[model samples]
Target chain A: MSAHATTEHAYVPGEIAKPNTAWIWKTFWVLVIITAIEFAIAFALTSPDWRTFRNSIFIVLTILKAFFIVGEFMHLKHEVKSLIWTVLIPTSLLVWLVVALVTEGSFIGETLSHMFSS
Target chain B: MAHSTTLESSSTPIYADAPRTGTWDGGNEPFKASYGKLMMWFFLLSDAFTFGAFLTAYGMIRHKHGVFVGTADKFFFSTAHWPIPEKVFNGFPGLHGMDLPLAFVALMTMILIFSSVTMVLAVEAGHRMDKADVQKWLLWTILFGAMFLSSQAWEWSHFIGGSEKGLLMADGSVMHGANLATNEYGPPLFADLFFFITGFHGTHVFSGVCLLVWCFIATTNGTFEKRGHYEMVEKIGLYWHFVDLVWVFVFTFFYLV
Candidate 1:
């Protein structure tokens, strides 16, 4: 609060603010552990029948990693709520795009198979 | 005459003469961020869309090829099926014949995350206006970024060179390496998507390193110190972290999935 006041009237670059290094380390460990789990899944689950299930796990883990990297690392979690929503609301539309394209692509794949058989 | 001019100008002032209701008014920062930081967030939002489109296209193409309902041994290096990523990215430096899968990429991912940690530390130091601390952390960030780029280069070269046996095409021609034209691993589009997405991400990392260097120099020359804030470091830190964030998705979709 005082930092904001000082910045408004008489800015002080040498203002002794407490650094949040511990939070950085905690975030770092979280990211590392999540990545390790991903690697383990990639190697341990090798059955082709498990492809869909494995991919789902991978996607969930990736989103978790993204949450930490963006929220904590980028400081969005601490930013104003409006700014956070502004950034997130639009990107959420990508989920729709992914589903639409994947469905469309499967249709084309079926067409290719029919033509080849004919 | 002076009083008349003042009244004329004050008649339609751009900002209201009345006191602002709260911080949301034009008189204060509603978002609690500077204009530059807000613009950076918008820019990153746009950039995310570009990457989103690219990755979505990759998913489309991979699905079009159809998934193989067989063992990975049968799927590996099969031209009729989509190549398993672990099989394709199994090479490790200095280990000629080992079939180590996803190991090197795991290392690369750790390197990037470490660099991100350093970058955040730099920003934290900047908050305290500690010049030496900021510089130290920035240097480490830059070095780790370069290391990640170097690892990517090695991976790219390995991809371009293809495997020793190579794939025998339907036309009886053995394709040795991958280009935009054909791939020894799988469909031509597979290589194309790999090239475009990873290459685009590499370009971002390259530019991020350049930006970090600029920030380091500016810190050394007391630019942000003179400006009474190290907000520049924080700005570049955002970009660096975004790059790292994109890699998380790329690593999952491109390599693991």
Candidate 2:
């Protein structure tokens, strides 16, 4: 760990690692392919009946893309398990918020539609 | 139970036995991460919540107002329902009167992803302590960032400048383009949210570009070399990746889904 005198905090960075350019290219390809698939679905699948299915596919793929970006690009996956958990645990609350919003928003929508109709 | 020991005459503190090797007892780095990196992670975590809240509210509003509930090509704009996003974002620059949907935004997404790749490369070059490679990759990242921002600006202007004829309001007025008060596309709030969310993300991207410029200058001057490490690049790389990550979701929710 080498500390820099210029920085006020004097951060001691961890490890002298080698560069992995191949991994960077691999991640780039994966992101591009995922985005291509998303575009394909958006353009090709145009049936109203497929709206929910299409949305589901997009959501799942977006989450998958998020996983790769966060895990590999951000280097969070290689961090110690404790550090990973610290980040993930707090973010899990977002899932709860999603669920709550869906339920509440639908209820509100139904109520508003009914009220305004009468 | 408190254990008492006689005070030692040595220079070592009396509480030296208080297990510090594998814990946050100040004897070691608990996360095995430097203080700066850890703080950056925490800052990003908080930032994630801010964005999460924005998107969640968007979702709620979308559900509340109700959507057009049709495929991209079959949708029509109306004030009573949420507009189909693809229809609103259909036009590409210099391709007026063409009904290409999601293509331009997809290009924007690719630009951001490419920039992210360059950012990671910069970080990797930093790991190798390769100054030339770091500067090269940072330059590419900054260029891609500018490209993305310019594309976004054109998109916003296209949306705002109105397309097709115009939508008629109940008050005998034609809402030609979008603003906080009204929009030709659909509900007024749709444009409002678009401006607010994308504007906020654009601000982040702009700030990120400034930071990259600073990092580029610092690299050119051999500041990190003198400091014996390139950890600053890694820190900034984390922020750049975060901006990309947010764009990923924005592209999904706003354009695709």
Best by TM-score: 1
Which candidate leads in DockQ? Answer: 1
TM-score, per-candidate, Cα-based:
0.91, 0.89
Across A1-118, the per-residue lDDT of candidate 2 in tens digits comes to 3253234333345433456688889988998899888888987887878988999999999999999999999999999999999999999999899879977888898898899576
For model 2, the superposed segments whose C-alpha errors exceed 4 Å read A1-19, A116-118, B1-9, B12-25, B69-72
Clashing pairs in 1: none
- The ten-residue window of minimal lDDT in model 2 chain B covers B1-10
lDDT of 1 by residue, A61-94 (tens): 9999999999999999989999999999999999
Question: Which 10-residue window in model 2 chain A sums to the lowest lDDT?
Answer: A2-11
Q: B1-257, model 2: which lDDT tens digit per residue? A: 11243333546554544543333334466587777888889999999999998889888888888767655557778888888888788888888889887779988998999999999999877767778889999999999999999998998898888886779889987778788888999888889889988998999999999999999999999999777778889889899999999999888888777
How much is A113 displaced in model 1, in angstroms?
Answer: 0.8
Write out fnat for all predictions, comma-separated: 0.78, 0.65
